[model samples]
Target: MTEAHAGFAPTGACWICGGERLRPVTRAIFEFSAYAQQDPELARYTGATVEIVRCRGCGFAQPAALPSLPDYFERMYDQRWSDEWMEAEFRDGTKDLIFREVVARLSDRVPARRRTLLDLGAHVGRLIQLAAEAGWRAEGVELNPRTSAYAARATGLPVHRADLRDLEAQGRRYAAVTLIDVLEHIPRPVEALLGVKRVLEPGGWIAVKVPHGPHQLMKERIRGRVVPGYRPTVADNLVHVSHFTAGSLRMALERAGYVDVSITTAAPVLPPPGQGAARAGRVAVRRGMTAAARVLPFGVRTPLAMNLQAYARAFV
Candidate 1:
């Protein structure tokens, strides 16, 4: 295992299965300093050769080296969560739709006498608000001081500036835990899932949404061939430390003492793929494909969909 940068170091074993054997899938020298700009002096020392590696045993692929959680959120992931981004997110309805799907899946399995929901990485508490609308007493846990305060004020919910490990330490428990596009960002996913299990009440459920890794790899490969150093364009390589497949996600949950893990595809509401004279035609084609995907069985849709979710129940 090779270190990509001075700060970023490779995990000796697989993050999902703890397997020792890993093979390189693709290699890209990630320039963290160039996240927002391409600085000539800063780019030289900051460039890290990131190799996307896969477990020989479990087929899970992730970066060879990645920054720790604290370093990433504070320094690297500097895209301002501005008001414009919030308005766009609301307009897009992507987050709301994902929350609805998660809520629907967990509604039936919620533990008796447990009506509370804890949302990890709940930026601005939008999902917390939605969970409240679904009749759960929802509160959020965020790590960013600014977002946590803003969310608490904006939504009038208990948005604490803390991590899941901190919540676990305080002996808090919830009937449902939601992590929308969050698991992939963690440096040690197995440890994080273990913490999630500890914070969950018996028979509680965890609903998670993550980018489909295989799809992302394919997209990146296509783009990288035409444009050099194209990996940064896709946000996953920049922020997401771990890239998950369906098998790896289920295995991680089960290893953390969760049972009855179910992985499903989250339907796509993406914009049209082209422009110009045939713009309307492209939109119709995209809509038709999305409709067909929705009707298809899980086995068929799991690979084609852009995103996937895992629903796991804590039996311990």
Candidate 2:
């Protein structure tokens, strides 16, 4: 529901790969969403006029006019202590659902008694709260002061308002670092990953989930707005700069020094192609999808997949 503005003309090289051949893919908008923090006013944003661009080389997707730092944080931040947004968690709680399952899956590596975990993008601290229920002493770093304060008050846990990279410099460290759906937001994911490594113990584990590159691009490729009889392509809200596939994710993580990295794909609860949404409920949507994928052959899986990736790169 964003304002209608014309997309920018493409004349420059791609942002990441620097390929001279970059192209405009879509003219769309993403509204202020409370998936991260709790802010009713954020809904006021309605949406932003965005010119979506694609890199022919790496297939990275980003808005041509991404909000400046001030606009991205200060303006759109949800600082109103809005309970409406917090209670609306069940509506779009993909971030929490993925984090919980990831932790349970890696429970073998992380002891039940482990009580120290850090979330880099802990807006409103929902992931940290969930981790605490499982005995993890969770802390987080969120840039939005409003959400950070609310998170601290609500969860009684520390949600520092600072850049993730600065945590290590401030004499803070952690055992495990969870970056759920964060890599996609950062302008420089590699740098953020490096910073995450600095605060992690030697041989610590990092669990990351990124949108499957090909899967997301496939939605972009669909090339139609009003299909006679089909659900809209899950609203391509590609605010992310880097869309990481299994291969690209592995490469970037390896360069960031994560050693034992493995990638597994999760079919979204709403199975691709209007298969009537995987299982209909919040919990079942994703968990059920993963369970179904485990039993079925690869031939009958959703092309749009979520990556439940866990890797232990070098601790140095």
Per residue, candidate 1 scores C-alpha lDDT tens digits across 179-297 of 88888787678788888877788888888888777776776777778888665333333567677887888888888888999887664444433455586575565445545656787
Candidate 2, lDDT over the whole model: 0.62
Error of 2 at 85 (Å): 1.7
TM-score of 1: 0.81
Instruction: State the displacement of the C-alpha of residue 277, model 1, in Å, after optimal TM-score superposition.
Output: 12
Best-fitting candidate, scored by TM-score: 1
What are the Cα lDDT values of the candidates? 0.72, 0.62
lDDT of 2 at 16: 49
258 Cα displacement, candidate 1 (Å): 0.3
Tens-place lDDT per residue, model 2, 82-113, is 66675454234545556677667556576666
Q: For each candidate, what TM-score against the reference?
A: 0.81, 0.70
Q: Give RMSD (Å) of candidate 1 vs. truth.
A: 4.7
